[model samples]
Target chain A: MPKHTIISVSDLNGALKDVVEDTFSDLWVEGEVSNFKAHTSGHLYFSLKDHQSQISCALWQFNRKYLFFTPRDGMKVLAHGALSLYPPRGTYSFVVKSMRPAGEGDLNLAFEALKQKLAAEGLFSTHKKQKLPRYPQRIGVITSETGAAIQDILRVIQYRFPMVHVLLIPVMVQGPGAAEEIARAIYQFNAQSDPIDVLLIGRGGGSIEDLWAFNEEVVARAIYHSTIPIISAVGHETDVTIADFVADVRAATPSNAAELATPDQREVLQIIANLRYTIKNRTLRKLEVEQERLRNLRGSYALNRPRMMLEEQLRRLIEIKRQLLRTTQLQVQQARTSLQLREGQLQQLDPNAPLKRGYVQVFRDQTLLLRANETHPQQLLTLRFLDGSVAVVVNEVSQDR
Target chain B: MSQRLSEHTFSEAIQSLEQIVRTLEQPVPLEEALSLYEEGLSLAHFCEARLQEAQLRIEKLSLQPSEVHPSTL
Candidate 1:
């Protein structure tokens, strides 16, 4: 045997992998990206370059999903990954595990990152927006009380529509802690029992950094959750902020926002006038139609021939009377027939019939004496004959014996 | 009934007149049209009285926390 000892194939391969992987594994690299290509095979390939050095990198799809925004060429990024060498290609590369934005300033990058983060959370959905009242009874302005923006808004509102009550919620809109003050003002307005109908939040035209408070995530979220409709008038027409995106409505300027919150008196008057005219003309036409109808009805047969109507009623009355008279005559004839039949029956039963037949009857006073035993001596009595009357005195009375 | 109709407020009378006009404009039978026309005339008289009595007033709104300021124009 020579000085070197013989080794198995598996032991030699394991020893080579340990030397290659352990030396460069778990490395953090910072550089500008270039020649980046996201492969279809769920992996990203890019070259990390510095002024004097360059290294190839591979970020798989699993790691790419964690990135907040799309990675592009020439973007500065910090990547952490494991270093490895492909034996087949005989080239070294970094297999990235995570990455973050690098070149931009920390604040701006943080802002952009947070904005995209919240937007993904649906903090800026249009469906969450509320419509501003068409007619706001009270309008609240949240800005510096002495600012020209407030002046412009007030002037426009007072000039256009004087009916809207203006409420000024004074707050610092710039410098340190301005965002907190603005947010508190918004919440305070919300807590009011009878809050303003709409809130106008804005300032005059300014630089991006000057209006940064409105762009702050806190203020944007405050406006998002506000019960009152907010009209954002942060800057000029071209200037847009997160407040503008989150507000119910966005106006070009403070004056324009005020105009939106309060309707123009002239325009409203014109609308009322138009409505009045429509109502009047329609009503007049309706009245004319009704008058014509009435005139036509007055010319109808029922109204034209009053006497003919009376004659028809009289005819009905005469028919009813004839029916009544016929019924009454039949009832009377029936009654008369019944009376004559009753009279004949009475004549058949009459005791006076015997008197007319020459039968004699005796009576005392107005009483007929039926028995001789009823008479007493010295009793004066009147006798009634059929054709003559006589007076006599009863002596001794006796029976038929 | 006519005096009661005359007592209607401005908006009430206007609204009623609008209703009447709407009813009269419909394609109803002649008998219904005649009755509706009669109603429309009474509404028109009420509306005329309201307009005659209406006076335009422009007043500044009182800025209160709770009070609702009416539309001036």
Candidate 2:
């Protein structure tokens, strides 16, 4: 011991540093963030703490933008980075490269982040929603085959509308790859020729983690973009998911969705029967009223007096005949008077009447001579009296003295 | 007119039946208008029978392919 060499302070520090760097480098840690501080050098410094331990952490500015959301104090986070020793303080710390919100424990933060991102993309906008059919011919169901939800839906639909067809797209509602399977099934059903009228995407009640698939962004986006109207029936009445926000309608349960899809067949039948009865009764009442109206019309004076109507018509005919006779007689008398006057005027202007008054008409070749100018000298001419005619030769022509 | 009536398509038949019901509701004596009333009643019965037949076929369709069950409902 007395012969051992003395060690320098620098050597001691160097050896210790190498050991600490080797021990701390290339490690991952998870803890709640606390007392976070940002230095002027553009580096973030914070302590990652569990109930039992705590470690200092630093995230440089280069790595900050990669974080999808902001970090807050008391936020449980899983950080991946290398542990390094700060030589100035001779303290060991973590240099974080990437970080994410930790656990099912931080679901609220994840949900908020997802919700914000989806909202910014307009996934929950009203314009993206589709209207449900007023009368669905067929409904598609995506749930476990043996689940009570299916039974409930079937029972409700059968009771309400027996004619509606239900197409079951059997799929696992929980466990691995369930979300993908469900989304694919919906797409497949939509692509079919006789496509389902509406899609009921849901499951019975479960824990939040069990219902986590419905909360997934992929599932929500699928529902949002679905051409078919979706009725979300997930968990109990109180539980809601991202799927619910994007669905066209949200029902309290599977049975409720069935109720929404169908109208009561019995009630429809009853209504039809009632309509038939009302139609018959009203028709009978109308017929009775019409018959009574006809009877009343027959009892009227005009209808009852058939012989009087005929007699009245005959009397009118007689009056019209008398008027016609009077008009004809008056017209005939006027015509006769006019004829007599015309005949008298004719007799006064007649050459024959003049002949009858002791004057004779002279003719040349059966042509009557109207004046002395019409006669030619030395022409054979015929002279006609009222009842006698004579042929004569013109010996001399003379003008009237 | 008879061929046209006979050639009535499914939707047209329904429409004609409804129209007949509406027309029958007007004031015509049943005894005096027995032929028209009989025609209307026959049309109504025919429509109802067609619907019932279709319903029966739909009931047959409702039965799952894997199992053969009574489809009374």
Which lDDT values do the candidates have, in the order given?
Answer: 0.71, 0.71
Q: How does residue A197 of candidate 1 score in lDDT?
A: 83
TM-score per candidate, chains pooled: 0.46, 0.47
Return the lDDT, model 2, position A77: 78
lDDT of 2 by residue, B1-73 (tens): 4532332343354455466567766655566445555555565566455334433102111212222111110
| CAPRI grade of model 1 | incorrect
Per-prediction CA RMSD (Å): 22.4, 18.8
lDDT of 2 at A119: 80
* Candidate 1 lDDT for residue A233: 93
Expressed as tens digits, the lDDT of each residue in A164-273 for candidate 2 is 56788777787544665667666666666765678888888987767766776557766876788999998889988778888888888888988877656555455445
Fill in the DockQ of model 2: 0.06
What's the i-RMS of each model? 9.2, 9.8
Instruction: Supply candidate 1's per-residue lDDT for A222.
Output: 76
